[model samples]
Target chain A: MRTFFNTQMEVLNSELIKMGSLCEEMIELSIKALQEHQDFYKEILKLETQLDRQERNIQDLCMQILLQQQPVAGDLRKVYSALKIISDMERIGDMALDIAKIIKESPLEYQERLENMASATVEMVHLSIDCFIKQDLSIAHSVTQKDDVVDKLFYQIKQDVIAGLSKNSQESEVFINYLMIAKYFEKIADHSTNIAEWVEYSITGNYVGEEE
Target chain B: MRTFFNTQMEVLNSELIKMGSLCEEMIELSIKALQEHQDFYKEILKLETQLDRQERNIQDLCMQILLQQQPVAGDLRKVYSALKIISDMERIGDMALDIAKIIKESPLEYQERLENMASATVEMVHLSIDCFIKQDLSIAHSVTQKDDVVDKLFYQIKQDVIAGLSKNSQESEVFINYLMIAKYFEKIADHSTNIAEWVEYSITGNYVGEEE
Candidate 1:
């Protein structure tokens, strides 16, 4: 039974990594779709569906482990944190799709600041999931700290949008789209921080985030 | 042991209701702050902190229930749903605070469209929690359906903001603030629908909404 539980946990961890990879792909594609002015909505929608299935599967596995294995303390926290982590990850996927949808509607010209923000957010997503898979507290803390960078970029983007509007160089709708996209990326960064916090919780039983 | 579990479950349910009520109050206060152009950030922050404590207490209770009682199947689902519901509730609190923060930054004049959207969102929050407390499938479904209204209102508000911009009547920063407020309300409505979907899942074991 112990070995079985361990194997199931391995499965859970791998499944999470798979879901995390999909999220990375989704975020990348969303940004690429915007940068290249390609229609990526269908692909993003497909990825979102896959993520939903992954979430449901992982949720079922977590419940089954709790019910069947009756894991105590540490093991139980791992399962619980997995459950929580996937929900955040699923939200990340949704946010990526949301960005893609916006891109589809209003494909604004690429801005260097927004691109830099997107890259930072993407890196955060990668690092957060890697930290979780490795149970690396240092990396988790780093992800939390990196959220400040995303926040700064978001404010900068907001300023640029305002400046563009004041100059009347960009149409209101287009500039608003840029602001929305930047805001969505900021939200994605927030969700990545959430995942990293949950990873810390799984290891130390301490949720270190805004909620605390 | 069964009786003890039942009692604890009762406590959990009541705590959830309490948290849900706080969410309702937070939404109302946020809208009121905007409408009256008053500083409600401190109050919203207070409510958010209370929500965090409530979430921690409820999560601890849930873990205790699962660890001590070893609830299975339907009983387990109830506890799990409670766990998921609180996360959404906490987020709802955070989003309300986000709206309040924006209101603090740029005090836009009261617009009827925004007021109507805020009222609709508040009602959705109320109904969603009410559905969870009562396990009312009809009310839950109603909340899910009502999200369309909020979405429509969001688009209308977007249009209104654009119109304001085209007429060069409102400052770009001010109109952008309105857009953000509307988007936050739309997100709050989404969270409410999520709560309602969880309520349905708890009662029927069938998840609904976009994730499925």
Candidate 2:
């Protein structure tokens, strides 16, 4: 029975890494499409569906573990944390899909700040999952720190968008869209930060991250 | 043991209603503050902390229920759904806080569309909790429908903000803030919709609501 539970736990860990990679790919492909004037909405939508399925699959597995196996206190926290983390992971997919739609509708040339924001957000997503898989406290902290970088870039983009409005109010629609785009990327970072906090909580049994 | 389990489930139900009420109040107060040029930051902040505490309390309670009681499948799903719903409820508070900060920093006069959006979102929050408490399927479906109204008002607000940018680019920051404020309201509705979906899932075992 112990071996059976541990084998199932191994499946859970592998599935999480798979879901996390899907998030990274969707984010990267969406941002790449935006930057390079390519279209990836078709690909992103496919990935989004996959991510959704992943969430449901993981959720069912967690419930099965709870019902079939009597997880100890530490194991219970890990399973519960998995349930929370996957929700955030799925939101990352939604954020990516949102960005893809924005890019598809308005193919604005990618500015440097927006690019920076995208990179930081993607890195945060990457590191968040890494921390969870390895249970590395330091990596989780780094993901939180990366959120500051994403925020700074988002602020710069906001200022630039406002400046663009004065120079050419005709593009006001696009400018406002740019603001929403930056906000979405910032939100992606925020979700990743939440994931990192959950990772910490699973290990330490203390949820230190402030409410998202 | 059966009696004790029922008693604990009752306590869990009451706590969820309390937390849901806190979410509704935070959103209503924050929107009211924006419209009336009053500061509810202090009050809303107080409510937010209380909401946070409620989340932690409810989460611990749910875990206890899972660990101590050998809940049947139905009871298990209810406990799991509570775990998922409280996260969304806390996000409603976070969205309210985001809107409150924008109002405090910029103090934009509320427009009718934003007002409509706010009202729809608040009602959605209320209806979501009402539905969950009653386990009414009709109310859950109505909550999903209300999301459309909030989305429409958000679109109108987006249009207005972009138009405002043309008239006075100097106030672009505030205009963009209005855009974000509307998005936050839309997001509050989205979270409420998620809550409604969880309610449906708990009752029917079919998770119909799409990813957030």
Number of the top candidate by DockQ?
2
> What is each candidate's DockQ, to 2 decimals?
0.47, 0.65
Looking at model 2 chain B, which ten-residue stretch has the lowest summed lDDT?
B66-75
**Candidate 1 segments whose C-alpha is farther than 4 A from its true place:** none
Candidate 1 lDDT by residue in tens digits, A1-212: 56998999899999999999999999999999988988899999999999998988898898899899889888888998898888888888998998888888878888899999999999999999999888999999999999999999999998888778887833888888889999999999998999999889889988777631
Candidate 2 lands at a TM-score of 0.97
Across B11-102, the per-residue lDDT of candidate 2 in tens digits comes to 99999999998998899899889979887888899999999999999999998998898576888889999999999999999989888887
Error (Å) of candidate 1 at residue A200 is: 0.2
> What is the two-chain DockQ of model 2?
0.65
Question: For model 2, how does the per-residue alpha-carbon lDDT over A115-205 read when each residue is reduced to its tens digit?
Answer: 8888888899899999998999999999999989888898889889878887888789888877888999999999999999999999999
For each candidate, the alpha-carbon lDDT, in order, equals 0.89, 0.90
- Please tell me how candidate 1 rates in CAPRI terms: acceptable
